[model samples]
Target: MRLMFLGDVVGRSGRQALVTHLPRLIERFRTDFVVVNGENAAGGFGITEEIAEEFLDAGADCITTGNHVWDQREALVFIAREPRMIRPINFPPGTPGAGATMLTARNGARVFVANVMGRVFMDALDDPVRPLEAALDYHRLGSEVDAAIVDVHCEATSEKQIFGHMLDGRVSLVTGTHTHVPTADHRVLPGGTAFITDAGMCGAFDGVIGMDKEEPGRRYIERTPGQRMTPATGAATVCGVAVDTDDRTGLANWIAPIRVGGDLEPAVPTRWETA
Candidate 1:
């Protein structure tokens, strides 16, 4: 299976860029499944039902979210109805949305996708390991599911790496989100899982983590909060990772980072392009 995971979509700029180019990306990569992190799609705060639908229309099979999963007031209602859109799994028992789901991919394969938040410097939640492991046990790849992926929505690189190593042989990919900046280290782990510290954001690279520099900068230097942070309006570089899984084992056979347009360097996943 050819799977792709896009990092967080910051706001209008990110959403527009993704909606505009996602179909082309799906065609160019021959992707079988696509997962997008949309926690920040709504004005750089939270995702809305309309925006989640927009992502599905653009070719994403499932949409994952992070710490800001409930940033928008409407999300609390719509997420309960949308099975394709999921929040962190470790949320208390009654959280509106699910943290994991088994969605059918474009190729008619059962794909297990889980969204989990890291407690390191973030909101406190249930310890992710036990629940995540139990979920994986039930959805065992190569038997019950064709492919598996976990979106480690987190702050520290250490926590992200720990998650990756902890679930190394169980899933096809373990990708990180929330830090916004793209990391250079992307590789297929020894256990055949694809991992990256941060898959980065699908928003503008010019600002601080896809936000306008003015406000974040002011707060740091002035030691006082000013205007609310907003998404940068510049052209966005769609940042993400691409993975090709083995048919039998459902483990990653190849992996690569993708960056296109805006301020960052453009990467075309030439391996697949030329394969």
Candidate 2:
């Protein structure tokens, strides 16, 4: 099974790039399922119902979020109704949305996607490891589900890597997000799970993590308050990882980082070039 996991979508630029290029990506990669991080899709904050629906319409089977999941306010209610939209699994028990969900791909493959947030350098929540273990325990890859994906929305690379190692061999892929900077560590782990320290943000590369550079630049330099940061309106590069998994074992056989458009050089999995 071929699965694609996109990084956090920043703002208008990220959303536009995703809506415009995702279908083509699915076709070119022969993707059976797609998951995207939409935590920053609503103007560099939380995701809104409309934007979440847009991602779904653009072919994303599931959308995951991090600490910013509630920035939009309306998300608190809409997320409960939308099963495909997931927030951090470590949130308090009564949280509005789910932390994991099962989605059927277009080819009839069942995919279990779980979203977890790292506690280091972020808000204190339930231990992520337990929730992730529970999700994996509930859905046995290669038996109950054709594919299992875990999105570790985190700030620290160490924490993300730890989770990847912890879930290796149990899940098809474990990719990180929230840093807005793609790392070069995309590789299949010893346990067969595809892992990347950070999948990067799907937004303009020229800005400061998808926001306009002026305000952030000034604040850092002057150490003084400035106008609110806004999303960069320039061209964006959709960033993510593409994983090809074994149908029988539900383990990743190939993994590649994808960066398209904008300032970042384009990258596509060569294994799919002939497909």
lDDT of 2 by residue, 1-275 (tens): 88999999999999999999999999877789999999999989999899999999999999999999999999999999999999999998998989999999888999999999998999999988887788888899989998999999888999999999988899999999999999999999999999999999899999999999999999999999979799998999999999999989999998999999889989988787775
lDDT (0-100) at residue 90 of candidate 2?
A: 91
Which ranges in model 2 have alpha carbons more than 4 Å from their true place?
none
Q: Each model's C-alpha lDDT?
A: 0.92, 0.93
Model 1 residue 45 distance off true place after TM-score fit, in angstroms: 0.2
C-alpha RMSD by candidate, in order = 0.8, 0.9
Q: Give the TM-score of candidate 1.
A: 0.98
- The local lDDT score (0 to 100) that residue 2 gets in candidate 1 is 92
lDDT of 1 at 229: 95
User: lDDT of candidate 1 vs native?
Assistant: 0.92
lDDT of 1 by residue, 1-275 (tens): 89999999999999999998789999988999999999999999999899999999999999999889888989999999999999999998888978899999888999999999999999899988878888998999999999999999999999999999988889999999999998989998999899999999999878889999889999999999678899999899899999999989999998899897788888867788777
